[model samples]
Target: MPELKKQSQVPSQEDFARAKSKSRQFDEIAGRVREAVLDEFRERAPISSVWLFPGQDGDLNGYVFYFATSDVADSLESGLSDEIEKALVRKSKELIGSGCSVIFDSHESVVRKCNGNYFQYLR
Candidate 1:
């Protein structure tokens, strides 16, 4: 009978400490990004309709920001503070291009659904 090798031991305290530090840093960065995106959304889109789906592994690891309508979505995505607009789009492209299907649902179809048409609300 062949004997199986023993599994590695749990991480040491020092290892855990290092991991905790890195986790804190990651959280700080995430908070900054969250603030930036949300602020931009509020400034450029309708307050009630804007939504920011914080990224996670299961949820496409990116946001699903939506507006009341496609027109609002487009304006938010393109007409917001130029700095924030560019940053948001760049992050989106990077996330999507990196094997994650991050989406920017403009709600164009939904807007038409409300009016019984298609692409009718874009402006």
Candidate 2:
């Protein structure tokens, strides 16, 4: 089994409900971040969404971006973890001194559970 990536935090029930209610706010912020991700992985990964991850410390650590890839395993075969992390940190820190985490997920884990992604409903 592969070691799951760190700096990633799953949303709680409250987080989900809050995100749904305030979907527009999140979408606005994420819309801008999308450019950063694309700059790094353009023509590589299809991004699903990016949203502020409200941290336990009562601050935004960074954001979580889910990929809309067909094969999570194969998509990661290049093992570009270092490059990806550097891109995220450089971009995020430039914007707000934050870093990010990329999520390799399936529809079952996200869509089936949440019905749909919040960003899709907005932008």
Candidate 3:
């Protein structure tokens, strides 16, 4: 006889409420970061997309900015990237206060890394 597979437990109402609250918090943080980035680099960079994910502690974890193409990603100077990061850090106290990670990469790279599980910021 084949062994029976165990089923996963469904989330309780309280668990669902907690998850919804966390999602709303993340959305607020992402919106602030998105606005700052767009205001600062709208004319300078061709950003394809942006994604944010929460950390294990349910705080803003990281920001991933994707350039439209590899060429666009490669064109940025290291110092400029650093400057951009610094500017972003300054624009949002929550990001700096939470010590969030920031990454700038090509769209293809991010898609591969995230495996289609991510929240993207739409303009």
Candidate 4:
């Protein structure tokens, strides 16, 4: 008789819950970062909302939380790095206060999870 092949194991409820939890965490973090970025950008120039994008193909391939505008999504794109820095610092504090280890990409992951819409820098 021929030996039967074993099937791949399916993810258990616990596994699925873990994934969901991670996703939820990402969303929360992303939302916070998005808001912070928008607030910071508003200090520099008029903005619409923040947009997150996944870096791909020789690009950063991570998450970029940025304000949007008509000019390449916005005229304030160049000024975003500073805003992101500020957001990170603030977020770190918040995370520390909450008694949680700020996991890697805690901010960026949130940006990516919001389908890249994480935050909007409205005018």
Candidate 5:
């Protein structure tokens, strides 16, 4: 019979504490970024609401801007949606020192997709 060696590496309490601290720092930075982005969108875009959430890997941020169907139509007709998305990316990088994904959709679509499990910056 072959003998199997036990796994040797384990995280220490200090390692866990350090990881928790880093997570908190990231959260704080993300919060600031979210607020700044929301403010900019509200002031310039025709969005009805904005949802900010962690990325799939939890190492980045994601934003969803919801607009009324009519507002979406108007923005699209005027090529404002593309401009707003570009501006959002630039603003996010400036604020977080990194880039994030931004999604634009109608309010009804977001509410249906998110299932009321999201926080919106405006409503």
Candidate 6:
């Protein structure tokens, strides 16, 4: 007969502390990346928000950003990926340098759907 192994029924305080520390560390890294990207985009893009998505296998290394529409027209343009495309494409390398993949959510297709189109809205 094979011997049965047992595991802890409940996590210990040390385990909780370790988990908390890891979460804090991840948040710190993600926050830094978000701030850096937001700062960079604010200079030339209509950035509404920046986010850092945790990477694969528990690594903190993924990013996504959204655009803020100033007006309906501006929304259309921005959503069409017109205003931010140049900047995002240009800054892809720089953003990725922070150890995460970057995304620019211009909301282009979303705008297109408003116009009853489900295709890329070229500016």
lDDT tens digits, residue span 1-123, model 3: 999999869998999999999779767877788678767877766666555555666444445455554634553654555665666666545553554556666666556766544444211
- Candidate 2's residue-wise lDDT over 12-66, tens digit each? 8999988787767645555566577666676665444445554454334443344
The residue-by-residue lDDT of candidate 1 on 53-114, one tens digit each, is 33454332333435445554555556553444455555544443222233344444445564
Winning model by lDDT:
5
- Tens-place lDDT digits, model 5, residues 1-123: 999999758988999999999878877876776666667667766676555545664334554555566777777788777776666567657765666666666776667766644454233
- Structural similarity to truth (TM-score) of each candidate: 0.42, 0.49, 0.60, 0.43, 0.61, 0.51
Superior candidate under lDDT, 1 versus 4:
1
Candidate 6 weakest ten by summed lDDT = 114-123
What Cα-based lDDT does every candidate model obtain?
0.48, 0.55, 0.61, 0.45, 0.65, 0.50
Candidate 4 lDDT by residue in tens digits, 21-54 = 9768765765675576566657764443443322
lDDT of 6 at 67: 40
* Model 1 lDDT, full chain set: 0.48
Query: Where is model 6 more than 4 Å wrong at Cα?
Result: 1-5, 58-63, 68-98, 106-123
Model 2, C-alpha of 97: deviation from truth (Å): 1.7
The regions of model 2 sitting more than 4 angstroms off are 1-31, 58-70, 117-123
User: Candidates sorted by lDDT, descending order?
Assistant: 5, 3, 2, 6, 1, 4
* Model 3 TM-score, 2 decimals: 0.60
The TM-score obtained by model 4 is 0.43
Model 6 local distance difference test score:
0.50
Query: Cα RMSD to native, each candidate?
Result: 9.6, 13.8, 7.6, 10.0, 4.9, 8.6
Model 4 local distance difference test score: 0.45
Better of 3 and 5 by lDDT: 5
Which stretch of 10 consecutive residues in model 3 shows the poorest summed lDDT?
114-123
- In terms of lDDT, the poorest run of 10 residues in model 2 is 57-66
